[model samples]
Target: MAAETAAPAESARTWLVGLVRRTAFAVRAALSRRDGRATAVTVAAAYLVAYHLGLGHLGLRAGAVVSRPRFDLVVVEDPVALATRRVAPFQYEPVALLSAGPVEYLFAPVNAVVGLALAGLVGVTLAVSVVAWRGPAACRIGAGAGAAAGLPGILSGVACCGPAFLAVIGVQASAGLLAAFRWFLPASVAGLLLTLLWVGSQVDPAAAR
Candidate 1:
């Protein structure tokens, strides 16, 4: 019985290793090409756009309703509803509102600039990782790191003034939630820089071959 179990475990381990190796090779090859990098950037930008437009929620407004404390700010998709107002007594009322229209219209140029910046960051990270690892492992590492770094901005954009990052999971908008961008803006930039440095270190020859 022990021998049989051991044999199956060994087979599974070997299979997993082979699968990882193949994936790594494929990822490395893709990132090595200019077209692949462009495609990746395009896909990332599309995801960002979709997320900003609230498509990330798949058109669902409110998911599961649960009781929670009120927030300090509320984000709305319409420019007309961007003003502050009172809610109820004892409950925290929203003192500010973040309108998606202003985010998209008034700061339209800023959006372009941020998008370009993210694309460049991802491209550079992928390029460097490909050089250092020379396999799918590099692509995986680069992609993971990029996603982690970009998460703050994505959450901020999606949440803005709703219910924190809860909207990403289909949660309904809540009152008094703070604007995510107000805090995440600087955090995203810091995360991006930290991720770049960390990824660069991962490829260091002195650390590993």
Candidate 2:
């Protein structure tokens, strides 16, 4: 029985892997439209996405007095190292408590770059989210709904801030949360209101009212 079960499992694994490989190839062909620039299209698209996802940090960049990032994931226990009383309170720096680091996930350079493309995805979603907030009465609804569906970066930024430029997720998760639970129409309206306030706050504290 054990031998028979192992045989079937091996067959299943082989079949699944082959199926996935075939599907991936087929998808590439279809998306490339047979002209064969699917790889280039994918790369260009990825960069456009990363640029926008990198913008989520605009809020924090705009908000924070300190705009530097602690790359290397190296621990900094020295309070003096921070050098600012304005320790990005909103910035997540848990020297003692972090989930797992993503070392095993991207084992290859190709894998790392593909993962980097993910930052673009975060950017596009925020770009859409910001766009959604602007249009008409429906803009708010569209913005919140778009953001909720597309944003996995909302929470993942805690550990995923590796490619420093893609810092948008770390900053915008709160705004994303505010949009997600607030029901589209109402949330959109509220977000529109708050966004106006956020903009106004940038201009003048009294104007924020």
Candidate 3:
């Protein structure tokens, strides 16, 4: 009797899982049919993201990075004094979408909704990377790794708002562009994303400043 009562709830959950799986596979198939170097570029991007995440896991942060004086040296710079100084080192500011900007503004309620969007995007990006990379084994591995990494971040809503969506767009564009050009598109796509993220992180605006 208890088993019967529990059956419908389990069935509904299973159905939802099946739907998500189908959607993911369909999107992957669509992206896979696009280009020659698409797979390679996406795989590379996934590797890069993974490496960055690992470094972060190791606690690499600008606040912690010791600064060396370019021309002269100061024994210490007071946080209070620096706050008043013009052009304090970048990390001094808070970043919503990496120190805050359009994404933070657009992703308002940036606390929860952005969290869901980011988690979904990270999962989508991993799925995209696998499809682009080709070969059954590699794709499976990438997908598995992405799910593992993304699920936790998604569940915790931590690190979800990083440059992830932009990376996905970069990967998608790389596929189409590379299909048209040669290896050129891959580098072009990558350079463009790296530049945007770097500038966005370092530059300013629109957080709660």
Candidate 4:
């Protein structure tokens, strides 16, 4: 009985390892194509913009009339250190402020860097999914898989500013609840990775090529 259970567990581990390897190969193959590259770039850029806007790092002024467009960038004296400080869950202190026309942005290096990394992951996952969708039967996967996987990532960005987000949603924030919000980004990242692996496992790299 012990050997039977152990054998099944070992087989499962072997299958999971194989799946991860296949997924890596599929992602590489997807990125090698022109359409996949274009899709990833476009999605990543859009996601980044949405993320910054959602975090209030970038926004438009309401009812503010500007006679002419203007631009300004103001940086703090100790920007590097400030950028490392967290203002909220997955959110960093703004080391600079930028104003262009009626738009304003708080430039947080860590936040921008992290957001970009997440956006890139989402973009790549979607790109691989698209490739699988368009590939032959052996490589095909459901087109919606990537989109569904990316939803949590988007939510994670919007939830990074916990208090503000909670207020918008009319949810009362408690000490415990606030602390739980901090895990959103990490959880979403893990979800994305798992979903990406699953999508990759479903695709045959040879067929994708």
Candidate 5:
């Protein structure tokens, strides 16, 4: 009876291992292709375009004057005020459809450029590490680490407020967390560099030299 149970468990483990190996092989094959770099850049550009046009808006503020028997007050509300009040880098509230204007057109390109830069850096790092190690194992390790490092930055871009992953995971997204959001880009870059270094170290020292 114990042998029967062990047989099924061992078979399950073997199946799982095969599935992982096949997935890794596919990913490595895709990344090793000549057009892989171009594909990465195009994907990065698409993400930026989505972020700019789909997620961003331009807003204007308008004020109303109220007169009382004894006093007068002017109440104001607008995009500027909302932006100021929100501690998050991006606004959590939905932008009105009509609010987007020339301002969005002007700023969207800038944001896209920044996004492209970040994505390009990641792609280059992955490519270089793969080349340095010259193996599917290196490609798999580098790609996994690179993706992990970029998660925070990607969440920062996608979230209406601060880092979306933290919020989704039930973290409060405190002031410190919001501030740390800005560091994600640099952190990803650093992580990629470390991945490359680690992969290089794993290689034959004579070959690495």
Candidate 6:
């Protein structure tokens, strides 16, 4: 029994390793061009901006009038400790407040890092999907794959709002449902990774050449 189990486990491990290798190769091939890099950077920036806007960290303050153009930064005391404070699921409290004209931005170091990381993943996935779809005729992938890659970002945006967004949609936020919000960030990351892996697997390395 032990020998049989070990054989299967070893086989699974080997398969997973092979899949990762292939995916890495495909990703490299996808980002090898100027267009691919441009696509990734643009998508990532857009996603980051959208993500922050959804969280209300970066937005125009309502009913705010600017008499004079000015920029201000207010940092909280013990900012390093406050930066780790979680205000909501996957949402951290801001350690600093930035004001410029009618716009206000909450600057949380951890949140910015997390948002950038997620944006990068989303950007790379879409970039890879584009290459697979349009690069070589031989590199065949699902028509919906690229579109599907955007789903995680949408989900994460909703997750950022937590119960407030759900309430607006007329769904009651139950205890269990509220708990699920905590997993949205990690789940979205997982979704992006899985989608990227699937997209990579579909692209033939030779075809990418």
Local distance difference test, each candidate: 0.43, 0.35, 0.34, 0.75, 0.45, 0.75
| Candidate 3 residue runs with Cα over 4 Å from true position | 1-4, 35-209
Better of 2 and 5 by lDDT: 5
State which candidate has the highest TM-score. 6
What's the residue-level lDDT of 100 in candidate 1? 36
| Segments of candidate 5 deviating more than 4 angstroms | 1-32, 50-104, 108-113, 126-174, 203-209
Number of the candidate with higher TM-score, 5 or 6: 6
For all predicted structures, in order, the TM-scores are: 0.38, 0.29, 0.23, 0.76, 0.39, 0.80
Candidate 5 per-residue C-alpha lDDT over 78-99 given as tens digits, one digit per residue, 9 for 90 to 100: 6444323433453333322332
Error of 2 at 108 (Å): 19
Put down candidate 6 lDDT per residue, 85-122, tens digits, no spaces.
88888788899999898899999898899889988887
Per-residue CA lDDT of candidate 2, range 35-139, in tens? Answer: 223333554465434322332321222222333432223344753444332222222222221112221111222223433554443333344334333431222
Residue 207 shift from truth in candidate 3, angstroms: 42
* True lDDT of residue 129, candidate 2: 37
What's the CA error at residue 184 for candidate 3, in Å? Answer: 32
lDDT for position 194 in model 4: 81
Off by over 4 Å in 6: 1-10, 61-67, 136-151, 164-176, 205-209
Model 1 over residues 111-187: C-alpha lDDT tens digits? Answer: 43454565454444444444334343544444444344333333334322234346556766445444433455456
Q: Candidate 6 — what's its lDDT?
A: 0.75
lDDT of 5: 0.45
